[model samples]
Target: MTCSACHQGLPADARFCPACGTPAAPGAGRPVPAAPGLPLPEDKRKPVTVLFCDMVGSTALSGALDPETLRTLTLRWFGLMSAEIEARGGTPEKFIGDAVMAVFGVPHVHEDDARRALAAALGIREALKRFNAELERTLGLRIGIRIGVNTGQVVAGSDATARQALVSGETVNVAARLEQNAGPGEILIGPQTLSAAGPTVAVEEAGPLALKGKTDRVPAYRLLALGADDPELLRRFDIAFVGRRTELARLAEETHAARRGTRLLHLAGEAGTGKTRLLREWRTRATGPGHLVHGAGRCRGYGDHGSLAPLADAVRTVLAEAPRSADGHQDDIALGVLAAGLLDDGTPNVPLEEMCAALATVLARTARTCRPVLVLDDWHWAPPPLVRAVELLHIRLGDAPVLLVCAGRPGGAAPPATAIPLRLEGLDRAEAARLAADLIGAPRTPVAARLLERAEGNPLYLEQLLLPADAGTPALPDDELPPTLQALLGARIGALDPAERFVLDIACVVGREFDPAELARLAATAPGTAAPPDGDEPPTVLPVLQRLRRRRLVEPVGTGPRSPYRFAGGLVQEVAYASLSKRTKAERHEQAARLPSVTQAGDAAVGGHLERACRLR
Candidate 1:
């Protein structure tokens, strides 16, 4: 039998052509020999990136130039465009009049096919500029080109006779539409192409476009430069990053170590701490210099299949960003592992040990070529399988130049002893003040200082505290915290043990600061009772308060039995108070209002609580 694409002879029993790698004819035991240069559309469909480039004003150029000159110019255009496409690893599929169509991931699949197509489109546009300049000098005529790129699943194979392989699908149509929509000397790309190319490519929003043959409008982006203009693309808010210089320095050191050997670093912190921000800063500085970096996050909810989701996502990205030429025996083994564990492709299932080994092989191959950094956020939410994958990578690829950086809330199964632990703390008073001022965009009000005091240096908390309210409103009491802040702190409070939560709830109604003796007295009394102080009989709230103290949810104001305990921040008390039922709140308030301790303070204080309890519906 003979191969149709490259005309190489193949075994009669072979299912695919060896030289061209095209599948044998459908229902044929062997591929039949065919004439060269024939078009054959196959039934199999695969993901591919398509590029379409068209010359501007072809009819006018033909009319202005002689027949021979027009033919020469057209030939020159096709030659230069095809060369550019081929240079970027794209196959120049066909020439349709003045347009050139190119395909990537055809004949064979490539990891970065979409990225290569983008590069080729940019190159073709630049080539046209230089080509037109030469034409202007010699033929006194200039021509512009419009290029478009799209990535999607496309039908790929030989037609009925299996003579020639063809690439055609909605991906091709979208690319053509984008080219038509593009202005002269401009390039446009579909959203999927933009996404596959990743954040490295800079682009401006082109808005949704009405493309022909597509029922819905297609969102497009104008292709810009390749490098990112803003390095911190994933930053949450536009607020200035104030602190974390020490963490930044540590990341730099770890990154330097990653160049020589694998390094695993876990960034642990509370929700409002700067774990993600610190990472964004590190990534902004440490991405280049012969390094391939990919990051993915574990989500809050995946139900039953949550364990391997993070690892599966990271593995998919690693495979996608891998170089096309890296395909070898090792690549095949690794891909087989992925097919069984992560990918949806129909490959024989493999054991977990083999799957992890294959995964290591893939990462090791990439690391041998360039430093590979995998950042997994929300590690605490990761399932056992994902955590195990990380452990496997640490053991197998320890000597390889791979760096794994994970960030999440602490207190899950800790990483291996060799892994570096970087715990992020909230900003200091000075740093918090600066961050708060930056957020409020005004001179420091008492409210601002109070917010900084309550927020306790947590960046997310500080931001929520300073969120703008309606203008010209009267000053809010320091205890009246923002609803967003309340909700955030409430979630943290809800996570505490039942006993710990109960103590905090009662302490909230006792005031910003409460004596254990006073709290115990009120706890044993009813709403209508006028309770007397229980003279420091070793308050039962002490044990629970001790736990809250260790959790950083509360703090001791002074020494001795009569000393007061305050919620670590004002927001904590507010959130605790907000969590109670109306009946419980009113009961707690009325009981406190009738206490001898409250009456000794003043009539105003007692009146305040009594009025609140009555107003409670």
Candidate 2:
């Protein structure tokens, strides 16, 4: 017989293409050959540990890089995974495209299938650390993997026609479920597998949680550390000022408690108040050996037609490392479903609740061995379905160490008291001053106090205020500056021609990160009179941002002249944007929002430019 994708030699009774590793579905290119001695359905029997491995943050990885680069990176990632799986005496069942399904004690029995699965997961984690560092420096990318394990009786089969370690039973489903529950860099195991494996990594009883699609509540645990806590283990966030100490300690206490068996933990705070920062820090401290599944949701605003942004980000992250092709020619089909559902955006498709449920099922199985970290940020503005899903997940994962930490504006439906609440308020005068001194590298004296006061002791405001103006004592005023933070931010807001102010408004709307190209194009068509800047050269409007930055209003991203700027105080930015004239604000917002995202050049947003443009017309 021959393979469908590639003409490769293979036995007539083969389940997978020997050369291309694709399914040998009949009528395409291959014929199924029968063996007279093949066991009847009842005669088939085998015992093996099913293993599931997937990438974390795979889709978003495409956003930061080009396709060609992503391809190379993907290959390297899978190469490492393939090597580890093979060395552990495991059968690489099939590639799932950015995910891999492998089995142990299949085709042959190992005395310690459970132990081997655990060993394989650990090996992959260790190999990935060095791999991730290099990738971070070269491609500026970060990736993680999750694994699930379960062992049970199975129908080991050679269809009267095909073969290749096909095992069908409840075990395979259980294993997939455990893997689905795992966090990035964590592994999950069912009762049968966990009991057999014994302790290699620290194990915490995660209690029991209801597995989706199944009526029974599956017992689970969370993997906290490979061994004991090691201070020497360097963390990514620690190297940058991005993670603040306050945020870390605030979330860590509850998280550490969760590892000891507390199930529900909620983190609440304002945007840019470092809620995500704390979550990252807590995750770094919490990851160990068992199931540490994590998922996040971020809310959408304005031009964004709402989203399950956090779940999408988390699922993509966890599945980023799945295998694309088994033999380098054909694609894995199960992974195709995930890719089409996740990465493909043009279809106007609303994903099935079942699909997310299935993914969660896999996550639960994957994370069954440890407490999972489910961090949701900016949840106040999340789509309604996402909120409902989260509520359901908490009840289902009640038995698992699935700590739910969230960051967003306050005063939503009140959370339970057991949910840890962290409120991020504006800094006190001294704390704000320390931050000003840290960012500016200049000592803050009584003179800086007035500046902090005007900014209302807002750290973001303080940082922006410290930016140097071109001339003496900066271009901003001291004489009765705008009163509140919004007014203070608006002090220099009215100065620019309509175009520059329009640009600022968009920057404020887009949050902390944005692309200058999009901002520029939006400026061109807005107000109708604004013209496209000549050449590919960056518009001279950079000076507007420069002036804004110096006045401690805008903060330049990327340190490039053409780089976009963002409001230092997101609160101020939000309030200022709200204060604009409806028609005037709508005109500029409509025009600027018309442009595609920097990475999504061809796929214009739905009803994008037309809808906004129509408002003005």
Candidate 3:
């Protein structure tokens, strides 16, 4: 054998150049293995980035060019693309006719696999541009290609060719679909790719695209440039951060204490109440001085069912930043324990106590050098083992200068003993109105006021209500609120008593505000009125309305005979109405049409309800 590097002849079994001392390339001096059947090695679950690139006009090119000419062009094209992919440390998996597929984090895994795949994709774009220019000049033809990049967990293995490949999963499928969906000469990327690339790679918001074979649309972006945005890759709500001064001040004080020694703080709030945003704002403000090691992790409601998922994420972040820490020994030990306990690609089967002790010891050791701040978001979704890990971290690192901030919806495992609880509520009326104006780009109008009323000061509610479809002049449109809010409110309503839910459903039809007298009269007189399906007599309307009032689904708006009860907010009414089937809605609306209040609103109101009811099949 001869060395590829120095062209020196070597023995048959040599692994390195004896004279030149250059190690041979991987798998050199080894016998080729027999073809493995269907499954291949490296067929385990792990995070990976897949990239697909396709020629735009292969059929036309094939028809126009001679077979020999087309074959030459295809080979040259594949060579150019393969070089780019390999240059960025990716494996060019295979070629399918006019398309080339490459994958990163298989055969071997890299921390920056996603970034590598993305870089390779961008590199291919430049190479293709240069190739097309040269082809146009030399061959009197110009060609275009579209590329798609995605990062996900895939079952990666070789196919029948004995080639290293992504054998199965929706990850590679999504990448192919994304490539097909891309515009000519455009590069599109999935959400995971964008996230792993961080904010360093500037990307234009391409919105969501409905890729084939996927039940739901995938969020995608177009690669623009390479530089981070101001706040990094975190979700930019575009709505100004408003009405969190007090919470920020409290967090600042707690963080200051943490800098001195161990301090744990919990930022608790309901969904859409600005927990994550407030955390980000504080991160930007607290990034200087004694805060040297800052790592954050979050628990997801989906795709994070593993034990210690949040802690694993946080440990990975710490290891990624460990080289900057002054205490190299502590960093090494911490990273070693973390990687072994939870960070490895395989599922860990360690005892909960052992995992906690390892994490706490590492965290304590690292905190002594520079103040280490760990932020754990969405702790409500964290498993019991992870929650125990947080407590253990506090117990072991109590004297270390480490700050642990956790945020989530309330009522899970209790937080650490030393942790201070900071509860976040909705914005006030004036602040919410100001935020609406800022988002809508207009002065406060009656429409904005109505929207604010419906939103009930919830920031997410306000922002969603102002999205293009729901945004209208003079009033908030009578349409379905955002799906996120619908799901959230649905879960809440699902917890209510069936009888209470039934009363609330009818009240929704009676309009936002209703008198019990009217609701009861309508229910009694409505066609096909029946007792409760459970064989129990229906409860009186006034008592049920009072129970709903206590539940905050409805509120008593007036004293006697007038509008005694109104929905807690317009959104509450809308969600309740939306949850009902068409037939039920029509029946409720028909019953409501008989109310004297509806008659008082005049023929238009009564006619509207009756017409809507009639339209139902």
Candidate 4:
């Protein structure tokens, strides 16, 4: 094949470009140029560990030694791992400022990337051992090196010439995190990779752990012996996940109780406020005998989406774990198990009753076995018929220590009082600042303030305003602001009939506290007893006003002869008022001025004050 880099020719089995010093990017399929002229892309692959290693304490070490000595030291260190890495068929992606990133099973496929990565890690340790020995013997100077390896898939390709195919994924991130957490002469890897490569390297189980951005604490094992196979030691040697500190502690308290007896907990939250985050966190913390079963039904289209969906899902998962004999116990017990507090008719055809029975059966089995976490997300959208079934399951499920977590949308649409609620607001200025700093890679104090103003402490909005590239700097009306929430309010306001709209418009001018007499004059709905052609007395607007309150659109601010009503909520009322015709507005002001002002010697009051404002029109 011809060298894609320098256009020079090369033989089969040649792993890298010779003339241009370009490596053949790993992939399964034949390398086809992108067009008339372009390099190939990395093949589609699953998660794998990626390792990026850098020679640390270099600047200090380089200053003490000459360039020749430094290069000699660097090359010697590189020579040990360079061949070792290539031997395992890992692509040495690049070398930068005393650092290098190597990827395994990327473009080329490997069923066990985790295994290959762990082997490479062991190789690095070996290389360090030899190099450290040589340095002590020859140079008489003791120095340390650090290595970080993480396994996951990356999009590899020539960033420019398309020759350098690099694996870019969170695997790379975990490697960096592993390295950052490393000390001199240490190697760290993720648990999944450790398991995949277990036979090759010896590791010791560290403990239950947590990591940043991860809701759950990860089960971690420390590498004690390379490829140790002592079954007992097998449990110990794996990667330690670090991050969520609080969730782990709470799970420990809950699950420990469940191990002794049946227990239940209702983890509740609005969608995306981290309910799932906490569930995942609990999983890591509640490992072992207390298994977890999960299912979710999102509330999107239906007032009732049928609770049976999640209930069915949860039961199906639990049933999968039961042995064949457990099925016999149902008939063996000689008692018809009521599903979700509802007795099932002996017919097998009713899905609702069958679903209820499934929960009862699962709950009974779990009581005999280990407690498990059952999660259902978005119960609000469950279809009306599904509501009773789902609610029954929740009711039948008692409160002890087993987790019964359900998350849904906030407000009336919120979960029942049985579920604990967490009201999520926006981030404070500091969190926004921290996030912004992380995005920008530096602190922009001024930019942070701007985000606070636009976001108004709404994490979702603040996050949108902060561009991914520069968190502190807002993206503006273009890529930033959430136009949907604004549009939703606007659409709701737009859907209102003219009379309702008129009430809101006049409310803006007369205010919620305006005298009823003045508001009736402004809105022209005060005239009573006007019969329609059908002989229906015209509907009083007070009913319409109350309807608005029921819909949470507005409310009566006072009850008196000069009572006023306020807009149900939000700033849209003002916008509606501003949309009125100038002449209609002027006439309303004319009517308002004739009313007595509240401030004028008890005779002319605020009514007159509002009337004066109306008169000015």
Task: Name the regions of candidate 3 deviating beyond 4 angstroms.
Answer: 1-235, 287-289, 322-328, 331-335, 345-349, 410-419, 441-447, 469-504, 513-537, 540-566, 592-617
lDDT of 2 by residue, 1-617 (tens): 33423223346567765432446555433333211111112122345678888888888877877888888888887888777776665777777778878777554444345666667777788889999899889767678888877766565642223446677788888778877888788777766565444334456665475677779687766544444211122112233344256666756666656654435555655332445555666666654445455665554321123245566665555444323323444224433544566435411133555444444554444344445565666555444455555655555444445566656654332344445557665666666666566666555534455677656555434544454443112234544221123322332343232334445665754445566666555444444333544664334445556655654556866666666666655545654454444465556555545445622544355355446546755
Estimate candidate 4's alpha-carbon lDDT, on a 0 to 1 scale.
0.49
Model 2 RMSD to the real structure? 26.8
Worst 10 residues of 3 by lDDT: 34-43
Tens-digit lDDT track for model 3 on 213-239? Answer: 878777788887666322224234565
Q: Is 2 or 3 the stronger prediction by TM-score? A: 3
Lowest-sum lDDT 10-residue window in model 4: 35-44
Model 1 steric clash total: 4
Residue pairs clashing, model 3:
447-475
Q: Count backbone clashes in candidate 3.
A: 1
Each model's lDDT comes to: 0.68, 0.54, 0.68, 0.49
List the candidates ranked by lDDT, beginning with the highest. Answer: 1, 3, 2, 4
Per-prediction TM-score to the true structure, in the order listed: 0.53, 0.35, 0.53, 0.39
